[model samples]
Each structure stands twice: as structure tokens, then as C-alpha cells.
Target: MNMNMNMNRKQGQILSERFEVAFNQVHDALRDIVQINDDRFVVLVKVGAKKYQIIETYKKDLEQYARLRNAIVHEKMEIGFYIAEPNAKVVSHIEKIANVFSRPNYALSIATKNVVYFDYRDSILKVTAAIKEHGYSKFPIYKNKKCVGLLTSSSIVKWMAQNMENSSVNLSDSHVSDIMTYEKEHPIEIVAKDINIFEVENIFEKAHRKKQKIEGVIITEHGRADESPLGMITAWDLIQIDYTVD
Candidate 1:
């Protein structure tokens, strides 16, 4: 029984050391991402609070772990003996956090690569056919080689409802420009390609809190409207992502 207790204690000490290493790695990863050169705690508070939802969700817990790490490292130890050992739960939590930083899902990695878009002058018939044949509900409407607006199935439905009164109305006769209305309420957000999934999730969360709808995130090289979009991310795309942290 005494030997077993010693073994458990030794294992706890080893795990505590591992937790410290992982905690530092997570901090370093954040520092690199946020370009912070100050204290790790400051980076944690700023980036965890503002930038990433995953880190924000675990912020308090991570802060507590950081304090614990400091205590463990700074505590006086007897010869070849640990003064304190980290709990298994804390170690596990820190490990999960480390993994989150290490294996991040970037926007470019998950976004739909081959985007199907329509020009503003294109016939509505083409848009309808694309929707029906390709199962795509959203399309970026372009003008002068720049994405000016988004055409969604909901907008099309609304347009159809307003135009159904005209007995002579036909999709072939209507242009995308005619049906497309600038939706000031739900504007498409542009984000850089390097943005992580956690940041993207935070964007949606913030929009929800403000009662604003984000139609989609248009990923570009520098997140500029003038730059050609590299990929696209919708709320549905985020919903389909399995964020089950291991």
C-alpha cells in the first residue's frame, strides 16, 4: 500500500511537469498568433477574452491552471521529492487546451474551395438552375470583377413573393441585379484566410448578441473586398464542423 501511494505521487509529479510544459506551449502559440511580447498572463487575458471563443470559454479555468503552474514551479521541493502535484483534472484540461492551439482548423482549410458565383447582369434563370442542380443556396453576386452582394435562397423567395403578382413575370426576363437588394441588416463579413475556426465561431457569437445576422464570411488573402475570395464560410458550415476537442 505504501509503495502504491508513492507510485501515485510520482505519477502526479510527472503529470504536473507535463502540464507545465503544455501550458507554456499554449501561451507561446497564443503569443505567436497575437504578436504579443509581454507577459503570458496578459496575452491570455487579451487574446482569450477577445479573439478566440474556445479560449474565452475556458479562460477562467486556464487562468486558474496558470496560477497553479506558477505555484508548482515556484514551490520549494525536498531533495528528489515534489512539494505539490497537479490534479488529474487540471492536467487533462491543460492538455486539451494545448491541443486546441496545436491543431487549429483555419478558414482556408475548411472553406468551400470551388465557389460558384453569378454576375449582377446574369439572368435569374441561371441562378435558379444552379441552385436546383448544385444544391447551393448562397451565391456571391459580382460586378466589375468584384463581389458586390450576396444572393441567397431566402432573398430569392422574398423577391418571388413580391413579383408573383405580375402574371408575365419570368426568371429568364429578370436579371440578378434586378432581384438583388443590398441587405444592410445581414452583410457578408470578410475575413483573412489564416483566421482559425475559433475566431470564426466568435464572430457568429458576437453577431448573435448584437441581433445582427452574418450572411457569410468571405475569406480573402487580406480580407479586402477588392481581393478575390479564396473561400467562403457560412453559419451552416460552422454548424457542421465537429469541434469535439480531444
Candidate 2:
């Protein structure tokens, strides 16, 4: 036995003893490493081109296990995903995340609290600031406390570029309301609070395909007008989910 082999055996023994499990065949390799990205300290995992996120608050000493596996991989190794296993343990592992995802009010409603909206009479600067602040590429324009239309960053950028050469350009003259596509003019797809993220994801894709220019989905309790727009889910928001955590 060489030194490297002996060292690996010792490490394996330590892991087995710590986890209280006998060694088995390698299940899956962990590749495309990810770690805590958000303030919530969630574990993000990446494999190939796909990614998964797991809320780390419930991990209970799992971080130690994760660090051990990360050290073994050292940018050259991969860890097995608990979900890929057929054993009963996989169910419990999945349940932890399911609990977070299953709570509709927590997942969907929480997002609504931070939604961005633009008033119809607001100047371009006001609209621009809201977009930048909320990190949303598009926003819902409201007039008289009613939704007027959606204004997109792309449209605003185009207008800016068109008047770039003109030194007399007055951004204040341009009101978001003038540029908004009134709610009555364009069809809006509203997602309900009870819907799953998967379904909300589908609505985003479908709306994008049909409206080519639209990228935002207004979420509501029952898709009603009286219900204030909870939050707008966008393609950009959904794409973030492509990454994984395991």
C-alpha cells in the first residue's frame, strides 16, 4: 500500500464512522460545485449544466458532511445526490426541501412583498430607479391605483438610445404611462397563490412564447383584479433555479 492509498483509506474510515454507515459502491459523482450564495445560507449544488438549491437551515450538521465531500472532490471530484438514491433515506432528504417548497404562502407570497411597480405619471428616472432597485427587467405601470401596462427595460433602453445623439433630450418629458401597454390592450396571465413554482415556471415560458415581448407574470390569490399584484415573476427569476444544491 502506497501513502496516498493509506491516507484515502483512513479518510474513508473516518467518514464511515462519523456517518454510522457501512461503505457501499459509489452512487454518483458531485460535479460543478456550489455553496452558500444567498444571505439565508442555503446550499447550492451544480451538476453538469443543471443546479439545485437546498435550504441549509434544516441541514443540522450536514455542513460538516458537505465540507468533507467538498474536500475529497477538491474541484476534481463529485458527490452523490441524495435524491438519486433508491433507498428510504432519500425520501427524508427530499422531504426537508419539499417542506420549504410546498409552503405556497412562504415561497410565492414572500416574493410578492418585494414586488416593483411604477406609477403612470412617474418620470423615466422614477421608473428606471424602481427597475434598478428591484432588479427587475420589467415593471407593472399603474395609473389611478389601477394597472395600466407593463414597461420593459428593453423598451426604455431603446428610447434612450434613439435620443442619445440629441443633446436636447429631456428624460423628464417621457412618462412611463405613455409607454405602457394598457392592461386592457394586452392579455395578462395571472398565476394564483396556490400554484406551485413549477406551474408558475410554465406560465412564464408560455407567456414569453406567445407575447415574445412579455417576460413578467402577475401573481394573485385567485387571479382577480381586486387582488393587488402580489409580485411579478420573471424569466430571469426562474432561470436562477437552473442551478442545483445537494
Candidate 3:
């Protein structure tokens, strides 16, 4: 019985040490991302509450763990054992959080690449065929070699509703510009290839609060619309990775 108690104590102490290490790593990662000149706890709170989507989800839990870490480090040791040793659960949580920050998933990593787009003059029939063939709901519309707007499934549906006659719309006669009018309300956001997935998720959240639904995020070389889009990220893309941790 005594031996078991000693072993448990040792395990707890190890976990406590590991938790501290993980906490420091998280702090450093947030510091780099947020560029805050404050204490570790302040930085953690700021990043947890506003910076990253994954971290923001666990903001309260992280703050609680931060307090526990402070207690573990500041409290006096009792007979070579930490007075407050972090349990396995806390240790695991901290490790997972640190791992996410250490090697974060970027927007470009998950975005759909080699995108198929349409020119402003392209026939609506061609666009419809591409949509049917590829199961793509959103398409970037270009004009003079620059992206002018996005043609989405919603815009197409709205257009069809407005123009349909006896369940038939003139697809060949209609042009991409005809549908562009419907897309004016659903604007596309652009982000750099290096933007983290968490930031991308936050962008969607902010847009939602503003009641402005962003159609999609165009991933460009330097986040400039003039640059060719390397990839695309939608709300669905963020949903796939929101709660998943590597």
C-alpha cells in the first residue's frame, strides 16, 4: 500500500512538471502570434479569448489550468514532492493545447486547390455543367485575368427562381455577368496562404456576428485579390477541423 502511494506521488510530480513545460510552450507560441508585451498569463488569456478558434473554445478551462499551474509552481514542496501535482487529465489537455500551437494547421493546408473558375463572358450552361460534373457549389468569376466576384450555388438558385419559366431557364443565353448581380451580397474574403486555420475560423465567426456571411475565403500568395488564388476555404472547411486536434 505504501509503495503504491509513493508511485502515484511520483507520477503526479512528473505530470506537474510536464504541464509546466507545456504551459510555457503555449505562452511562447501565443507571444509570437499576438506580439504582446505582457506576462505569460495575460498573453494566454488574450490569445485564448480572441486569437485562435481552437484555443478560444477552451478559454475557461485553460484559465483554470493556468491558475493550477501557478499554484503548483508557487506553493512549497512537501518532502520532495510537489504540493499540488497536475493530474493526467490536466497534463493531457495542456499537451494537446501546446501541440496545436506548436505546429498549427494553416488555411492553405486544407483549402481546395487547383480551383476551376469561370470568366465573366462564360456561358451559364458551361458553369452549370462544371457544377454538375465537379459537385462544386462556389466558383470564382474572373474578368481581364482578375477575380471580379464569386458565383455560388445560392446565387444560382436565386437567379433560377427569378428567371425560370415553366421550370426552364435559358442557360446558354445567360452569361456569368447575369448571375454576378445575385452575388453582390455574398462577398468573398481573401487571406494569405500562411494564415492559420484558427484565424480563418475566427473570420467566419466575426462575419456571422456582423450578419455578413462571407461566401468563401480565397487563399492568395499575399492575400491580395490581384494575385492568383492558390486555394479556397469555406465555412465547411473550418467545420471539418474545428474540434479536431492533432
Top model by TM-score, which number?
Answer: 3
> Tens-digit lDDT track for model 2 on 61-83?
34444444344344423343221
TM of each candidate vs. truth = 0.67, 0.50, 0.75
lDDT of 2: 0.50
- lDDT tens digits by residue: candidate 1, 157-209: 87887777656456778888877773333578888888988678767767887
Better of 1 and 3 by TM-score: 3
How many clashing pairs in candidate 3?
Answer: 0
Q: What's model 3's overall lDDT?
A: 0.80
| Ranked candidates (lDDT, high to low) | 3, 1, 2
Look at candidate 3 and tell me the lDDT of residue 95: 91
- TM-score between candidate 1 and the true structure: 0.67
Candidate with maximal lDDT: 3
Q: List ranges where model 1 is wrong by over 4 Å.
A: 1-12, 27-51, 56-80, 83-93, 166-169, 182-186, 198-214, 221-228, 235-240
Ranking by TM-score: 3, 1, 2
